[model samples]
Target chain A: MDALTGAWQWLTTAANWAGDKGVWHRLAEHVQISAVCLVLSCLIALPVALWLGHIGKGGALAVNLSNIGRAVPTFAVLVLLTLGPLGSQGEWPTVIALVLFAIPPLLTNAYLGIREADRDAVEAARGMGMSGPQLLLRVELPLAYPLLMTGLRSAAVQIVATATLAAMAGGGGLGRVITAGFGNYDTAQVVAGAVLVAALALAVEGVMVAVDRLCDPMRGRRRAARIGRGPGERRGARDDDAVAIGGAA
Target chain B: MSVPWSLTAAAWPSGQVPADPGGPWLPQAAAPGGADCLVANDWICGAYLRTRSHELLAATVQHLGITAASVALGLLIAFPLALLARRRRAVAGAVLGLTTVLYTIPSLAMFALLTPVFGVSVAVVITGLVLYSLTILVRNILAGLDAVPAEVREAARGMGYGPARMLFGVELPLALPAVVAGIRIATVSTVAMTTIGSVVGFGGLGNLIASGLQGFFKAEVLTASVLCVLLAVAADLLLMAVQRMLTPWTRPRAGSRSGGRRTRATKAVA
Candidate 1:
């Protein structure tokens, strides 16, 4: 209880929110790093995954490879790059490390999403003499939108969480607050930093959830379908969606 | 790279100290104009492994111990939670929602939040990991239970099987594959997250990697990382094998679709 109050006091301090090393600066650094990594990961991963998922060949191998990537600890990759020649380059090691960490989820989820898009719709589009890109954009992409969003949300959240390691590598982030607090043995500051990070992560999740609902092309159809279903089945379907989001993260 | 002549002459009473023997592929450990001992900074040093074998072993053991305990505990807790959710529609949303929210908490922050209560102990790591595992385990277990064929339950009821007997004998056996799939994912991820425990001073290979990063000790970071990856791969393979052995009926034969469907279902969940 005392520690909680101390953390609150630390968070409330005006002096702590100013200057280069202030809470706002660290939060900006954290968000900036996470955004850069997320964009890089999506750029590198989404096209390949979507193309491969479209062709329906080699996606298995690609997905399996990324699964292996998941087992490679992000911290290990970050430290290895930092200790290697990349160490000489400022923030390059951190950027490269985080991009690598963010790619697997994006790749796996995007590929799976595209591959699992409605086959009947694809057939219907093809029968109507639609071009390949037309079939993909008009038929497949819309169907896959929900899953694609889920992947993006998970990847974004993960990058935000893992960006904290940047502080360990002498880069800037909210993690620096916790590390600095540890340096000074200021438990209050440490707790405050943790609270800030947790809140940021949850806020990110909530925003994505809203975006997912807003952007889904199937929203009306899904809601109508839900209304048609019995209450018990409706709840089961909802649970599965929540579980998928959690699993992706 | 050969040792410089001046330093060699001064250090060795003999005219020259021999430079490191040239290997076609390997870099010289004892590079001149820098740290004298290769083990102190080299990327891959045999000497460091020979000297610190005990320490490496201890860290690896601690890592394995923590991962195993956390996943085991997670499964134990998830089983009941899954059952409770399955019991009613009202309870289902809350259970799944809570676990998902818990799953979103970042590891560094999770530890920091936990430390106030657990005080930098192994308990903090274990508790956090168990919470993390709940999302996967509960979902998979519930999925498995739901997938059990309605006809099978009816047949068991016709034979006078009670709820307890049907769950253990009929439903659980059928659910084993999905349950095991969940375990595999949870265990592999736990192995990776276990390194984060180093922040609290209980991270197994994480401890070595953390310390190594601070001083830029390449061999320690590289070796510990390799071991951590190998451990995750090994755990995944072991669980897959257990799934195979326990659910022989689902095994893929020449024309069997059951195994293929199971694999797809598991992938869909992940």
Candidate 2:
């Protein structure tokens, strides 16, 4: 399509990739803002969720509360913060709103991940003289890795995509380019910005998947040890799990 | 507190109208100098209603209309996709994967991408939102189909129930809770995402928030923000009530501790 070509041309312009308005600079800004929000979200949400999940108490309430938070629409929250008292705090309003936006999934999945770890492995760990923290660190967290990573992946993808809200608050990111394109009525530039954000989101997902696979403590061993199941039932379960991943997505 | 404690409380003379929190207790302070409106409290109440209520009402209707149409369209599309996906795991994976990519596209980007083709109409907003609602709705529908227990299917077949009859009478009834849960999630999330439509000047309550923000009218911003949250929460609860009313068959099955928790967790995460 001519539109695609125009978008490509817009993206290909070297001038578009330089200066404060450059795609690269905005990309960096986007990543920085998302990374900060993600890390801070993980930091704030994970501990409380994992603790509750570990203790097997209050997980439902915490997840529900965060779900309420999630429904509060990040754009609304960001607008209020930016236009209110914190308006002059530069990027903090965006950061804080994003961190809040990312919390529900992080909390829900982390708690669910921990609480849903194999009961046998947990009992075995406890029977083996593993203390609370040790079991959580060694057995629980590692076993919970896939779901946790899924949560992280979900949160990370969302943050990367929505980080453009930074522009609304007078901060800088890839969103700025799109806003500028809109103001100028340049459809090509707008489409180009979309392409950039989409590419960034997909890239983040690819990297997260690799990291999830690589860091999984029980990856190859679990599959190998379960090989005696004659493959049929095992395959069904693996497929079911893939469906679970779909359900989460 | 003006709690509506009894189901029939509204029938009582004193309780007929109920109390409003927006009554005398709310902030009555005037706007700071250089703000958009005359007095802040006036914007919060009298003046905001007197001048801006009509516009607010229009935007709210637009917002509601866009959300309703998007989700309804999404449901219509997702149903067939879910059915096809149910036939094969590979199909399910591929379909779900495609929708996931759609979901991952930023709301802003989605709007921008649509602008070239649809030119800022309701079609643009609706299409983008339908794409978003699909992943969850399709996934949930498929999950519901998959969850129909094997023995139930076997028993239905043993009773001479044909494939179509079994699907409709047995599996569908069984799957209603999950399906309804999915709808609830989709609707609530759609309502929230609809606010982003204001970026291009078409979102309902979102228009108010955008205009208020640009104009530095705190009361307008506050009211719109709270209304958006209320809309989402109310939609969620209303759908949940509908699910409860329609799917009596699924309730006892959800009696176990783990079953309820799993449902809650799934709804929360999704």
Candidate 3:
């Protein structure tokens, strides 16, 4: 109980510190880094994903490359780039690193979403004399929008979280508060920063959920119906559908 | 011919053209100067190898061991929670929402948060890594379980299978492919994030790269970066192989368009 009280007290103090003007500046810097990185990653990845999805070639290679990008740690990449001729030691290097980190999900999800578009719908469009780009713009992209939005949402959250590493490199953000809290053994400050980040993430997720619902209005109805059904009934319905599909085929 | 040679040389002018068109160029002449440093740094070369090889090996082992342990724990916790959350849409949404938020917390901040209480050791590092893996792993597992055909579970129940038995025999097996795919994603992510352990002063290859950058040691930085990329590639390949091994039951049989169609349909639904 005493330890819990102490922790609470520490948290309060930290929150106070976080509210300081200097800390807010740092937080703003971090948000800027995350936003820039997210935009840059989307710009780089979306076009490539769209192109790959459209062509339906080099997808495996593009996905594998993006996976490799994810595997490479942001810190290590930042450190390497900062030590090289491009040796930017500040926010730019961190931005570049976060951009690399953010690319895979955006690229993969977008590519997968488009590639997984309803083939029959696409065929129907083509049969009506739609050109390749025309079919993509008029038919495929609209249907793929919800999944694409999910990818963007994922990318946004990831970049925001990752942007904090910039603090280690002396780039500013909410991470500086966390890092400083650690250095000073200020538990409250650490907790405050962590809580803020968590809250921010939740806010972003809520926004995304809303966006997802907006993109797919039918999802809500289907989800609600699934929920209202008893487990056994739900299972029966799914099984029946599968059996029907199998029989038809 | 002798008289012609003198005339050709005189006409060309020494500054305007080289005596031989195919002669080694100025840059070639400067190559030896570059090689001199490398030749003189032989002892440093050996020293570099001795120090780096030991550190690299130690870091690699520690990283792999920690990552594997965390991933295993993450899988164990996530799978059951996912299963329980399957029918409870509200609970699942909340869990998914929480995990997604958790997933987005900067690893560095999480480590920093842990360090004050845990004080910068292996325990804190492992805890952070495990937490990071849980979000994605749980989401994937739940999604996989949710994806199992309703008829399969109904069929199992009709066969007098209890909930536990049905889950183990029917739902889990069917969901294995998606679960493994999630695990693959989690494993690769955990491997990468383990590099952040460097901030706590626990040595990983990241530490080498960090120090190399701080001290302007180009060779060390290059070596660390190259090794990290190699490790990531190797980890991805290993996880892919493991995914294939574990989900052999889910593997497509010969000439079955069914497998492709099912995958496409599920993707559309998602």
DockQ of each: 0.52, 0.39, 0.29
lDDT of 1 by residue, A12-94 (tens): 99989888999999999888888888889899988888888888877766667556765777777777888889888987888
Which residue pairs show backbone clashes in model 2? B31-B40, B59-B204
lDDT (Cα, tens digit) per residue for candidate 1, span B80-187: 999999999688889988988888878777878887887757888889899999988998899899887676677777778789988888788878888998898888
lDDT per residue for candidate 2 within B131-196, as digits (tens), equals: 998988997887778777676677677778787887777777778888987887788878888887
Backbone clashes in model 1? 0
Q: Which whole-number lDDT from 0 to 100 does residue A246 have in model 2?
A: 19
The TM-score leader among the candidates is 1
For candidate 3, lDDT tens digit of each residue in A47-88? 988889988877786567656756777777766666555655
Worst 10 residues of 3 chain A by lDDT: A240-249
TM-score of each candidate structure, all chains considered together: 0.87, 0.85, 0.74
Residue A71 of model 2, lDDT score: 71
Q: Which is superior by TM-score, 1 or 2?
A: 1
Ranked by lDDT, top first: 1, 2, 3
**Model 1 segments beyond 4 Å from truth?**
A225-249, B1-40, B259-270
Tell me, per candidate, how large a share of the native contacts it keeps: 0.56, 0.58, 0.61
Candidate number 3, chain A TM-score: 0.77
When 2 and 3 are scored with lDDT, the better candidate is 2
Clashing residue pairs found in predicted model 1: none
lDDT of 2 by residue, A1-249 (tens): 666788999988999999988998998999999999999999998998889989999866865765575577667787888887788988888888778777777777788788888899999999999999999999999877767887788778767765876575467889888878876878899899988877887888889889988987888886765575464353434333332221111
Q: Against the true structure, what is model 2's DockQ?
A: 0.39
Evaluated against the true structure, the overall lDDT of model 3 is 0.64
